[model samples]
Target: MSDRTQEMEEQVAYLHKTVEELSDVIAKQDMELRALTQRVDLLIRREADRQSEAPGAAIFGDERPPHY
Candidate 1:
C-alpha cells in the first residue's frame, strides 16, 4: 500500500478510538445524573410528608413575635 493510504487508515483508526472513549464518558455522566435526580425526588417527598403530618407546626421564618 502507498504511504498516503497508510496514513489515512491510521487517522481513521485514531478517530474511531476517540469517539468510543467520548461515548463511554457520556454514558457514565448520564447514569450519575439520573441517580441524583431520583435522590432529589425522594427528599422532596419526604419533606412534604413531614409537613403534612404536622398541621399546626410553625414553619421556618413564620414564628410569632416575642411579645406575643
Candidate 2:
C-alpha cells in the first residue's frame, strides 16, 4: 500500500476511538442528572405535605411575646 493510504487509515481509526470514549462519558453524566432530579422532586413533595399538616406552625416557631 502507498504511504498516503496508510496514513489516512491510521487517522480514521484514531477518530473512531475518540468518539466512542466521548459517548460513554455523556451517558454517565445523563444518568447522574436524572438521579439528582428525582431527589429534588421528593424533597419538594415532603415540604408541601409538612406545610399542609402544620398550618401556621412554621410561622410561629418556638418564640414568645415580651409578656411570656
Candidate 3:
C-alpha cells in the first residue's frame, strides 16, 4: 500500500480504539449512576417510612432543634 493509504488506515484504527475506550468509560459511568439512583430512592423511602411510623417523635427537616 502507498504510504498515504497506510497512514490513513493507522489513523482510522487509532480512532476506533479511542472510541471503544470512551464507550467503556461511558458504560461504567452509566452503571454507577444507576446504582446511585437506586440507593437514593431506597433512602428516601426508608426515611419516609420512619417518619410515618413515628409522626411526633421525628423532627421535621425544616423545623429548628429544641435547643434553638
Best of the candidates, lDDT: 3
Sort by lDDT, top down from the best? 3, 1, 2
Among all candidates shown, the one with the greatest TM-score: 3
Superior by TM-score: candidate 1 or candidate 3: 3
Winner on TM-score between 2 and 3 is: 3
The global C-alpha lDDT for each of the candidates, from Candidate 1 onward, is 0.89, 0.85, 0.91
What local lDDT does model 1 show for residue 26?
100
Query: Which ten residues in a row are the worst by lDDT in model 1?
Result: 57-66
lDDT of 1 at 68: 84
Candidate 1 local lDDT, 1-68, one digit each (tens): 99999999999999999999999999999999999999999998887778778889755435677888
Where does candidate 3 stray beyond 4 Å?
Answer: 57-68
Error of 1 at 39 (Å): 0.4
State the lDDT at 8 in candidate 1: 100
Clashing pairs in 1: none
